[model samples]
Target: MLDSGLYEQLHKALWVQKKLSETVARHWVTTEYQGLTLSSHFQPIFSISHRRPVGYEGLLRASTDSGALIPPPAVLVLPNNSKENLELDRACRQLHLQNFARQETGDCWLFLNLNSQCLVTEQPDAGFMNRLFETTGIHPSRLVIEILESEITDRSYLKQLIKHFRSLGCLIAIDDFGAGHSNFDRIWELEPDIVKIDRSLVQEAGKSSRVERILTGIVSLIHEAGSLVVLEGVETRREALVSIAANADMVQGFYFAKPQQLISSNHEEFVSVIDELLQHQQRQRFKNTHQINENFRKIERLFKRAINHFSVTQNFEESSEILFAEKRSVRCYLLDDAGYQMARNIYSPHYQQTMDVRFTPLLSGDNANWSHKHYHFRAVQHPGQMQLSRPYLSVADSRMCITVSQTVTSSDKQFVFCCDLDWQDN
Candidate 1:
């Protein structure tokens, strides 16, 4: 619901929009221009945590008098001048508002796309939205003004217009934020409440694991910037999983629902989709965890054996023989209490054969200081306990590996025994 005071202020502030009271009716509002009829269709934007639609993005649907449809991209150009642009933009909003008001909107928002040209226009009249809100009995707070900041060249004017919208108590969203020419500069300047990620990013994330990680990082950055993320164009189950993995706050696409003339009240269908995705994710996580534990159990046995042998014989290479027998074990080395390497790395026969000679300079870590590594500090922090580090690229072989470190004392001096196990398979 919109706030009454906000509507009062808006109605008093401006009158730029063309009057549409005659066109407005009980169930819908339509504007005719150049023999074409314009109406509004809504596509839902769902909240991942809420498992329900938090809003619907209002899209324009234009058709000829003969009932042939005109794509929305072509509809914007129907208005030639700034005045016509303002009129069409306002008419579209009025139509969306009236139709949306007739539904059980509850507290969900109505996302309206404001033309950039109309936003920057120096037209005299204002208060169109104000009068519309008053007429439709929909609160301004329920409105979300989506602006494609990249299209507006006059950023100062854009900022002022956004500020005005904010003053009217409408939420602001930066639409298609990950598309061409879009940058964080507008996000920093406008400080929008929501940033809708472009579908291209969603498509790329679904195609590549590296892109999936990047998408997660991008979502994290947006959250840090104090705005929620809406991953748009999630058209498949894989893309939906990517959205969840990226931690996007909301999702909108054909995977859940498509744009329609009427809003669907059946939220259980959307809930079921999200429920199944979560279940699949949970199963995958359990399987990964179980596999990691099983692998660790085998490696730990060999690691303990090596440590015991080294403690008795004080021979690094001889003791590491048992560990090297594992196909995944890359190398083992001893480090002093201060993290200085105590011996040259004892590599597995497999590593020696497949090792890249280009990294010959880094192959021998004897006398190298590993104090800066997380595995070293973690092992030092908890003496006598095994520390398992997350998989990372090993500086020694340039291959991905997980480090298992344990601190042990020999001859009254502490030493850290560390082994690198290849993580390419798991």
Candidate 2:
């Protein structure tokens, strides 16, 4: 083991690194990313899918007062000094405003790492955030306060802090989620707007099912609670695609763009990239919409014909084969009034297993039983509601889809029919 002198020396070395990071962060206004001279120190890496604003993550890189880009992460891990951390945060905010102004974009929130000490000091300067907003001309709505999950985090105060930020019109985010031992339960208590999946959890998405399951559970849990997920530190198309398929609302990683002291210009190239994504989304959307419309029309026609079938013998074994059997892909299920499974198309891969399925989750809505699923033609729609299940991958075919449940009442007796729509086959 090292002696006290060596330990002290190491601490001093850490402080030196800390000071260098501050120097670099202080120069954030002059950092460049991909040749785009960011007028600010904080750089935002975004999702390539919808061009929707994710969060602007602060990067502690600095082009020298001498013009050299200081490395990141090390700058952050040098030493956890509260005062220094606060200063770093402030400088990051300043640079964040500068970059916000340059982009001519107003919706993306700037996610500045927060110093836990600064939060619990019982000394929130009322004007601090407002002034930062005023200086940056970034609206409070466009600011997200990012709290790193550290040992010192106190859940009670964290809740208070998140509520306080929200009171100021700013959003709250939990950064580096699932990386450390902090209480993720606070996320639910605080009701934050964003829950960023830590890079470590996302790093081995391809090789480790264990990693993927953990990542899946984290993302799914956050999404279930109504918060958006940003798959942070995405480094590969595979990672991004997997996260996207898992329903992540946003993604950030080096593959998209690395943090730089300066941002790359050539707006034309960025614009073209944006255009291509938009066109692809548009076409995909069109195809999905067309498929759903055709299904709806077919369903309407089938339902009119099936009304006689519904009124007759409840078991579809004979008539369904005579009617929908020719249609191949369409699926249907029946549930009794007591929430028990009934029957469905014999060909349905899941036929007769159970009326209540696992793939879709139902939610309550305007009608006693109406819900929506995400579809190609429509991002979300209730169609005709029985008990609407949110979208999920169908277990039978492993395809993205949603199931709609509705009750058909003849003379006050109610019977439920749940219809499933698969985007893959569509």
Candidate 3:
């Protein structure tokens, strides 16, 4: 007979052995999918500030017995069973981590793509992932899980999943952002560490100025929300410049390097390219700033001439007529020292007929106070100098316009002479 203590110890040993064997078997099964050997390719993610490769995203690749490459999308297709999908997901992750371990990555992060379906259907086993990380000698902080923005359905559940991964010291990234079904509401809720702008946006921005403006605004908004932006799929120098202009923190695309089996040791080469791009961007920004300053000077001269004429004639209509004859001023109005309108707005003949009925109430000179307006206060501060307001909605015409105002003292009475200029003209 066996002692109870001895039997208990033997039973515990058997359980540990069984678990280890199962883990190994599971790993072995992932090495091949349907007789095809699975592999991973790395694409470098470059940081604009660093001007070098900061990370590499691991992309899954598969090949057949004869070494024919299979399409990436085909590999993601799984059987109806959720367990099968989970197995494939684990296999891809294992291969990525193994490949990254074997390579000389050198203090850079490894971004791994996570299938949205598997994330929702087969929840991650934290213990298994931790053990795998320990076995591979990869720190959890070095791993970034990239999730497709379009695949997220349950906001609350996704938030919880993000929380779980964050607890494990893994960073979260929203991939293919602005591709389809882009809901900034969910983005705010998830609060991902990184947001990758989609390839389509980058491509379109290269072709259309309007699209570029929108992309720039989106990047600015994302930065304001405390998330780093990665401009993806930059295939040309123009596209990369567009990304730089938009103030993207990172860029990943063919312009840098295509997906490869090994991380290309071309850090110095890329640094040179980024430096040139940075210089070009700086020159362009400087040129734009100079042009804007010139325009401001010209507009100031026009406003000063109009103020001189208004101060002499003390006639809003005649002064506005003279200003509009130059085809720049949209409307002119007068406000007393207390910021109360002194007379009705004198509309430019060119824009007089285009005024919307909704803005009719603004034509009245009663109770309209300009004291709190930036242009009003700024002009008052300078007294005689002209001040230009940033673009704003014009009350008289309900169009985007910039106001140029100057405070003038004519016949012992102080008044603010204001002119509305079309924003498009500026």
Candidate 4:
């Protein structure tokens, strides 16, 4: 360790410059703090389309002199004095940068976790990280500053800190989204370059199709907000497949690789993993497409017959009985060209038994305008061609269902014929 005089000199030189003493090893950098060893480990983040590692998130590892490990939570617990916490956070960041500088990562980013304490305590324009970047010879563009936006209560301070980082050419990422009290407001306000979805959401997706669809919507919304989505904590093949199906931009977790000090040179290992996942997704997509086509064929036959009968006799119930004969059919209805319901829904007997009385107010569809729905507008857009919508929660019965619709011109009046099918089983 350097003497006290040399320590100040190194601090002036913009080295780690904290309470910890740094020791540069051959392959990595290490620091000593209260008799524990601090080191950096990285978990790879791979782009789904690129089929290779796009970047790595730096994780701090704390161990005893004898190599006994310490849990990350215990290691990162805030000290009673906020000053010590800030120093530790900066020290860990510097350690990560130094180790990353030695790796052969080639144009990939180094994602560093930024503690809320550091953001609150430091001056935004202090140029501390800029000086550190100069000392380590790492460009600011190569760094991704990860912040848990929920932890910072002061939106102004958070924005100022992010602005300062962006001014330095560092990419900003909202970390742990969808965990607790996370909303799209910050995403709209901060407009981060990347958003890391919390692991719990992905885990729940593996067990529930509803959660999986919700995940896909979340990813779509994030994309609409102009940020890439990274699904973290993917530990199983099922979770990885879910990520792919959800259209996540990137993924990171134990399923791909665990955190380690050395970056691997063999990129093909991860490429093969991505290739296999893509193949599985393609196969599943083909199977689902085939099933949906068969369903549409059956529904098409019944729908045309129903349309013909209703057109001539003007009887909704008698015409829709054939459609209600399908086991999955829930209800059938008709809408005018402007999307106002022309009549009450004809509910299948089996579906009527399972209706939730709590949603009785929404049971009647007469005069309700469904112009905003995809089923209505899509049929209007395609004219005579049938439209099938993805499964969505139906307000009429408060159950998950898919809608099949087609526009029909009968007796010179245009109508949109729609049928809902129970999606709980299929």
Candidate 5:
């Protein structure tokens, strides 16, 4: 309903915008992520673990003649003509193919980045990719396609794409997760192979120390989907430390090592560095153990003193008088070779009843080493005699006691009788 001149103006503006976008796309300004030059944060603290090529992450990058790196464009663009899109696909595929070929030096994994728009292309010229894979002969397992799924644009289409690629033996991942503000519903539906924690969240992780609580919950959520979590953008030691504590399975960030050309011969160097760090960590742990042992010794001494006090008391009736004073009851146990197998009690009608009472071993028999069921007692069976006998339980007063009938002797056959204890009843 606009006037002719106004409509023309608006159309011209849109045309200008489109042309500008195309121009930016044409120049390789390095508009995407840089290459595999990742590093670890532990490098500064414990030295870089630089002996082995742990794994290689596919970094998407483009550069112009000026030698400046250009990050890949964030937005998806399709040219007016199918010819341009097809040509672009071919060139991009070739870049990846070449990159992967150079990267397959050992057991290193090739983590390639895939945009949602690209995978769903109707007829991308995948010939170059197929040829590159064929030349490398790397198992599909070695190639992990990292899908930077910001949000589920098309659920059905995304799932179908995942199935197709998975069938090709490639793994799928959903990246830039938290920043994208994605819903857990989308994650459950897509069921990606990996979910990378956003770098933004990691950067803020330790500034408040609240990172762990948040990251832990996030990791727990991701695991419930039957997929692992890879913490991305680990640029600092603090971040790396916290991430590990948060139970991150794998870490990919500049903290370990920046992405680089094939690790080639430097694999051993990486491993050596790791060994050195492990040794240093071990030394620190040893020191900590010594400190803990010293404290434990102090505690042990105190415990022994308390046990000795309990073992040396000899007046049971007198001690129990303070607790059950009116009852005038006294009980004792033997600590000689005639030990009780298990706990038992004996009943006596009068102080002289023990003179004719029959006593049997409480927990006696074959399994002597494991005789924890009973305790030996050289108890005050009568007013003057401390008799040692079998364990017995007395129904008369709900008490466990033993008759002192047998005696223990030393190696020279001398009677030894010093272990007498009387604990105060509460």
Candidate 6:
């Protein structure tokens, strides 16, 4: 009894609904790679601050007909055919989307790995991803595309691809950072939401104090760049502690949980572990700070007493000898307001004897201008206040030393008193 126009519209609506249903059904269909079924296993990525799992990385794994597992590399290997590689990549992504839906992991992001070479070379089907998202019910915003850092060669193409992904509401991450000629310039251009420090760096950091310091510095830089850092490959308590000390935003590795068929159910245990590590770090920091403050106070008192004596002494050389006996100072000199040395340096006898012949040029620094030195300018600004310079190799002895400078007035003439202290002894 409906009008002709209404009947035609209703029939079209029904047909469209049928087609949408078919597309949704097709999204769940599994793909086979070399007669093996592909599936996804998720590894949880935890937030150090929150002490909870913020998201999961979907790792692709294949299973044979006999139910034997196939490693990811084996499944991903393509025989020099771009078409096959693209197909495999699509299949892996689809599998991840399907499994994510099946697992019901709650409002958490799914980090999916994208091959940089594939993305750079292939012209991706725009509608294909739109259809997949629509059919699978996985929103683009909840997905994070992690690109391997080493594989990217053509940055222009990569930037365009990243823009395309972002337009779809997906976040970007640079994985395996600090490995294989990692470029900070490119990273800043990419402006990724996350940077995963390579496992090798994390492992080396745990084993070497120097490497740990470097890792910490790297993490600090990454944070300054407006991105989160994930210290990957933490396999022991020491490694986790190292990551925490580095101030990593997140930590992931076997120490927490290995990549398994299902997301980890032991969230409480991991949280406890993180809390314990944070407590230990806090205690250690408090102890170190207290000790350092005490040491600084002692050093200040020593310098103040020495300066009082030096100001009162009529014989400068005798006072210098007394000061050198009490403190492990290398040399002391007087400089005018213009940063030109006013007198010869009073070098410690023991230090002078050990000085390298190659550095004899430094001994004749009287009347030399030091206006370019940071300590000179800083001391001028804060007259009568002591300023310390960071440790640097001394030009006189080729040994590490710290420079301390103080601007003082004697008989209405302002002069800067500069002293060098052995860094190791200090």
Q: Which lDDT values do the candidates have, in the order given?
A: 0.86, 0.58, 0.83, 0.88, 0.50, 0.80
In angstroms, the error of model 6 at 312 is: 2.8
Question: Each prediction's Cα RMSD?
Answer: 9.0, 14.1, 12.8, 9.3, 20.7, 11.1
| Displacement of the residue 209 alpha carbon in candidate 4, Å | 0.7
Off by over 4 Å in 5: 1-54, 66-68, 74-90, 119-129, 268-426
* Over 4 Å off, model 3: 1-30, 294-297, 333-345, 352-383, 389-402, 410-416
Query: Each prediction's TM-score against the native?
Result: 0.81, 0.53, 0.82, 0.91, 0.50, 0.78
Candidate 6 accuracy as lDDT: 0.80
Top lDDT model: 4
How many steric overlaps are in each model, in order? 7, 21, 0, 0, 63, 0
Error of 6 at 39 (Å): 1.9
| Tens-place lDDT digits, model 1, residues 1-426 | 669998877775443121232223345767886788988788999998999999999888989977999998788887778888888787788888988887766899999988877757654234877888898898989999989888888888888888888878899999998899998788887899999999999999999876787799889988988999999999999999999989999999999999987676668999999999989988988998998899789888988888888777788898888898788889998998789999989899988888899999889996799999999999999998889998787998787789999987777778999999887732
Regions of candidate 4 where Cα sits further than 4 Å from its true position: 1-27
Worst 10 residues of 5 by lDDT: 38-47
Candidate 4 all-Cα RMSD: 9.3
lDDT of 6 at 147: 87
lDDT of 6 by residue, 10-81 (tens): 999788766754654554446777799877777888899988888888888778899998888887775367
Better of 4 and 5 by TM-score: 4
lDDT measured at residue 275 in model 3 versus the true structure, 0 to 100: 92
Question: Comparing candidate 2 with candidate 4, which one achieves the higher TM-score?
Answer: 4
Better of 3 and 4 by lDDT: 4
Best by TM-score: 4
Q: Per-residue lDDT for 77-125 in model 4, tens only?
A: 7455667778888889889998988777899999999887765865644
lDDT of 3 by residue, 280-327 (tens): 999988997897678677666666777788789887787777677646
What's the TM for model 4? Answer: 0.91
